[model samples]
Target chain A: MKKLIAVLTVLLIASALVFAGGNGESSGSGKKVVKIGVYEPASGDNGAGGKQETLGIQYANAITPTVTINGTEYEVQLVIVDNESSNDKAVTAASELVSKGVSLVLGSYGSGVSIAAADTFASAEVPAIGVTCTNPQVTLGNDWYYRICFLDPFQGTVLANYAKDTFGAKKAYALAKLGDDYSVGLCNYFIKAFEALGGQVIYETFPEGTSDFAAYVTNAKNGGCDVFYSPVSIEAAALIIEQANTQGLPMPILAGDTWDSNVVLAAAKGTNVSISVTTFFVEGSTDKQITDFVDGFKGYLASNATALTNNGGNDEIAAVTAMGFDAYYVALEALKKAGSTKGADIQKILPGVTYKGVSGDIAFDKNGDAVRNVAYVKKVDNATGKWQFVSVQSVK
Target chain B: MGFLQTNLPYLLAGISTGGQYALIAIGYTMVYGILRLINFAHGDVFMCAALMVIYSASYMPLYISLPLAIVATGVLGFAIERVAYKPLRTAPRMSAMISAIGMSYLIQNLALYVTGGLTKYYPPVPFISDSIEIFGAMTKRVTIITPFVTLVLIVVLVNIIKYTKIGIAMRAVSRDFETAQLMGVKINSVISATFVIGSLLAAIGSTLFFSNYTGVTPTVGGMPGLKAFVAAVFGGIGSIPGAVIGAFIIGICENIIKGLGWTTFSDAFTFVLLIVVLMFMPTGLFGEKATDKV
Candidate 1:
């Protein structure tokens, strides 16, 4: 009986490991395959955003399945790894991509994981194009990491300017998640820009795994702030929106790129609370490129139930997804520019590679950051459950 | 009035969450009373109840789905004991505890696999999820209803343990596991009954808890589980009333701290209370003094 139990335990563990190994095999196709590693969190706080970001890359891959390098056509296969939206897991995820022998990498919607995996990519000489990781630290001092989205400082200032100029706010309440690189970094920049505008800013941070935002929302309400800003994960954002709406919070809520998601819209839909965010792309754009991508992406999502659910059960295009699509094309551009599958060659050629993505014109500056200044501010249309483009703003 | 207006929201939130924690804590306290082992998986059971509702509600009516999920959770709790803890009943106490910890991880990982690590939005239960005002402060109707729900459940649970034949058998078994078995108390059934009742309360707790919090993740149970465990220990691990009171105190204090702008230390405060309680009163507030029969 004891031996039987031991065997069962061993079998359970063995089966678990096998299940965890998860679809790492490459295709046995006739064409030459060039692997592009997708290191993003498919689970955890940033899972919703990361999954949508990944969907964009997947959609882009489906649309452009092959890329030519040195006049030879190679099948573009994505090697996706879930960093679990944790800094600790990022190293392993990055190494898994590195070990997979990917030519170039795209992704990591959260800046914390992107920054965490920066050293791993740098050490492996792998060039990573960040999809929507907006923290400046993601690319600062890390030559191997490149991001398509604008930095937190730029996003933060744009939001601050919008809050002051639009809301005519004197005092603002800012809440961020403790120890979250993206939330804290963006909150700090927002505070700096808000205070610089001669506006009083009250900043507070809640610990991770905090389900209750009642106290924090009450703090914002009682503090007599004119505008409330919390640049947090989608999971936390939903809870906050619920709490804010419940409390009849008087002020409009402002956030950075993270809040520009279907999750936020769903939470704030048919609610009295006001929410606005600065992001890369707005869905319902008349721009030919964006319109084409949106139509194609929605159709792609509709065909797959899993992808549609991962996109928060709708085809509403998130800005991160748009950036993810752009990031994929940017990586392909790098591979084409280098004309080689070598990581070192891709890294060297990445600084010069440019592409006119659906999001915007993506060109890498000397610091390997996107040379862009303008961001589109979007407000949640509560009645419609869609994002309404307010205006395009830039830092002077 | 001004002070009440400022602090009432935090106090109300604390009480609501405390009641939720109380529901979970009773499970810990009761299992510890009978088995003398910490049912670490109790929190995951609470989480599973929420997940069950989320998944079931997609296909079935809310009323049917809620009851079905609660019943399923109770069954899960019963099966957990039969599979994980029952076999190790004769083994060393530490072995059952290790199994409990293993079971906790198993449930969390299984949940992770099923949800694919996505944060599932808890479908709002009507009426209870409705936003309402209390003394110029706003919160869910569930918040006001939770403490009463927790109290009523505890009263019913206390009476079952005090009066029913199975309750007498349960008390006998908790008082002396081997002796109760020798006295034909049907120790196994008592243990199973304890798990079912504990799990039912946890299910109800998850309902109220998720209505306020709403975002249900795979590992969401870990914090509340640990907090509920602390509440059990703080109140006297074997005493249900003690656990409930301890949960409320921790809940209120934690929220008050957050209201004071010390959000980082809210989680830290629960552990600090545990250590302080352990240092001064080892057996907890209502725990009977340990006596050796030499």
Candidate 2:
């Protein structure tokens, strides 16, 4: 009986090995495998945002399955890892991607994590294409890190200008989350630009892990500010929206790219406040290319309900997802232009490569940042229970 | 008058938040008193209660779900004590403490796994979350009710400890474990009762807490747990009244500091206050001086 049991165990182990081997060979039997690594936060503070970004990349991969390189077809496989939305975990996640031998990488929705993982990618010589991490330091001195979206400075200024032009605001309240690199950075830029536009600004901050915003909203109301600008994460934004509405602090609420979330939209439904944000993409564009992409993406989401949950349980397309979609196509274009799937080869070909992506016409400037001027302004139409496209503002 | 007008809202917020801290802190104190072991899992029990509401509120009606979730949380606390703490009772005190910590990690990671590290939206209870204007400060109804609820629970709990048979058994077990066993006290049942009461309070606390926040995350219990634990320590670790007072003091101080525009220093100020209290009083405001016989 013991011998028979041992024989069965051996047979099971051998079959498992055979199945694993069979799975590996079927993907690249006659084609070269080109890997694009996704380092995202599947858990942690920024997990929701990171999951949405991953969905966009996965959708793009589904649409464009293969890229031809040097008269040979290469299967594009995505190697994904969860960074847990932490700086320390980002280093480990980035190193894991490096070990996977991915030709290029697209990732990281949060700026702090992206900046944390930048050195790993730079040292490994693997060019990383950032989707929606808007902190300026991400691409400032790092040659290997390229972003497909505008930086916080531009986004902050656009928001400040929009407040001035649309609302005719003379006073603004700048609220941020303390110790957050993205919130503090964007808040400072907004203050500077608002002050430059001759608007009085009162700056305030709340500590991390704070679930309360009543005091801050009350402070803003009593301070006599016409506009409330809080560039915070989505979870915090949800609470702020609810409180601000209940408090009846009737001011135009403005934010940077992080506010472009369906979670925030869902929270803002039935609220009295007008929520607007400057972001990388808007779905209801008249541009045919964008319209086609949005339609196809909706169809993709229609079949995949789980994907919709990852995008905050709504059908609305997020700006970060659109940016993720564009970042994937951009990496593919660079890979095909290089005609070789080496890090250095793709990095060389990436400088001049441009693709009119689903989000926008993506072209890199001298600093490996997207040289785009237009920012989409979207507002939550509480009446319609949807995020409505307002207008596009250009940084002149 | 200007100062009073400006600071009234902050004071109310502090009181509401303080009540939450006290509710959670009482759990820490009571369990510590009975077990002579710092039950680190108490905070995670609070987190589980909040998550239970978020999940159950989706399918069940609010009225049924609220009571059902609280009872489930109480049962979870009871089970945790039985499985994790009860086995380590005969072993060294350190073993039970470590088990408590282990149970904490287990619950947190399980929450993380089940929720997929996503923040689940707390289904808004109609009247509990509605905002009402008081003294020109607009705040939720939960904020006003938290302190009164906490006070009523404390009075009822204190009376039980002073009078009831199970409560008297609990006191005896906390006073002397071996002697209580010799005197025919059901030591195991007493410990389980302690957990049940602690878990009930935590469930109630979590309902009020999540009502204000309106969103639940896996690590939601972590900060509040740490703060409540700090309140427990500051109030003299095993004393109930001390824990409640310590929580209120910390809550008020942090909010006032934040309202003063030093938002960055508010959290730091909490630790600083803890350190100062430790240095000065040593045993806390209402803590009894214990004499150890070697």
Candidate 3:
């Protein structure tokens, strides 16, 4: 009799736990709900950047809670999932959003995770809008993935030119993390561009989970290189920055879009290291739309402690957050244009949808990539821990 | 002179990293000496110490928080053994080992939940974090401080084992668990002491290690923990000095390999060394030769 009771109690608790995970299909307020899946890394190499991106979406959702499609007011609900900044986890996270039956998805701070989940979204017929994923392969052949950020090829060339022209650097040392698609891909593009500019380039790849970058920095310094470039994730970037400062690296450091983060700023602050990165948007822009975003996003971040911590313990706005804010509005525009909440319907109209975002005017080309040409180059001011605008770079 | 100038930084980093590994290896070696079970959770315990310092330092001053964190980690280690291992004392040895692995994951997952998977930055220590010049090569002062700290701690630990009553009880218990128990050696207290000492060393190691690296994630301890385990095996699991020497060699070699631009092979080299050592010296450099019982 005791054994029977024990088994019955166990089953009851298990069933209760299962039921606790409520379905998103039903709304208690008697309103039609349109779910937008948020696929971002909340915990991994890209977790810091991912949270800031998600913050933009959350802020956008808070301000515009509903979208009027055709004559009905449909409530917009966000389904957020952490991709954990890994390829295998990205597929699982993508499938989870698909299973949640999201009408459209906005996501993914890192290009590697975005590319990893491309096929999943393609098969599910769900359209995903990339926020800050800069790798070109993210939307190359996958009709389902649409990105708002500029591709790596442009960003890489811009940084390489900045190195050669601004710093007068002739020899460049480029380092990347092995197996990380974003760093390796961006590093390759930078190398190609640097070499094309009649500069000598030496490159090396560090394995993942590498906390010790002393040797790599020493190699760069000892190699008699004029400039150092390592377009890596925010995590590795911080460690490398510290090592660079410790080693008293004489040459300036260069990186791609991933370095345009407050995490990078915080790490490079108060250090003697010089860091420059090309990114989508810079904070404190003179444009009215960007100013509004900077003000409102700062207010939103200040209101929530968790959001502030996720923003690297400050109210400083990151470029990815602005892109995230823009990605959310773009999803809404696609929904409004399509006039339907089905994944297939959104996919059909995404390529035709264009919205003026805080970053810039967003319009997709035939490859489902944003038709962006110019990138903002910014340098970290080590003294004040602020970003100083360097120049607006564009490739002819 | 040119070769030395170019490779000096790598050698320094290796020695510093080796010192940190030695501190963690001692924890593995000491626990293995008594329990004969690999406390896989030792690495997690080290991570917990770092998290504790990072979180506590936010509220209290470093002087108070640092020691408080180390003491709290020791308590956590004591609690883990009592909860996970003590209940299964009479069970098969494999069960205890499995429990250790489970405890490791449990602590890591708990840390992940608390930090929300964000990499928490380790607050910089004043003197140790300052940059210093060693033979014209620039590096953190912790590189110079780590070797001395590790040696001092080892000397104190060795002296305690050589002189103290509790230390003698621990040795007897490790040598013969049943005989020591029959002789009223108070087996549980000795076991608890072993855990406390090991955890305290791991805590200290975490301080020196993270002072240089400066980033503390939930899974940060996994690699160092694995490397330290290999160090223990290479030096003979139950030998303390052997583990220290093994850790230094591995640390230096790994960094020198990175200097050679073989960064990809550095981690793989540690395992290759382990396999070679096992094949040639199964008993390890300082390990006692085992005799079969009739």
Q: What CAPRI-style quality would you assign to candidate 1?
A: medium
Candidate 3's residue-wise lDDT over A107-169, tens digit each?
A: 899988999999999998899999988889999888999999999888888888899889999
Candidate DockQ values, in order, are 0.80, 0.60, 0.79
The predicted structure with the larger lDDT, 1 or 3, is 1
Q: Could you give the TM-score of chain B for each candidate, in order? A: 0.98, 0.96, 0.98
TM-score of chain A of 3: 0.95
Clashing pairs in 2: none
Provide TM-scores for the models.
0.96, 0.94, 0.96
lDDT by residue (A58-106, candidate 2, tens digit) is: 9999989899889888899999999998888899899878876888889
User: Which candidate achieves the best lDDT against the true structure?
Assistant: 1
User: What local lDDT score does residue A198 receive in model 2, on the 0 to 100 scale?
Assistant: 94
Question: Higher DockQ: candidate 1 or 2?
Answer: 1
Assess candidate 2 and give its lDDT.
Answer: 0.87
List of clashing residue pairs for candidate 3 = none
Compared with the true structure, all predictions reach lDDT values of 0.91, 0.87, 0.90
TM-score quality measure for candidate 3: 0.96
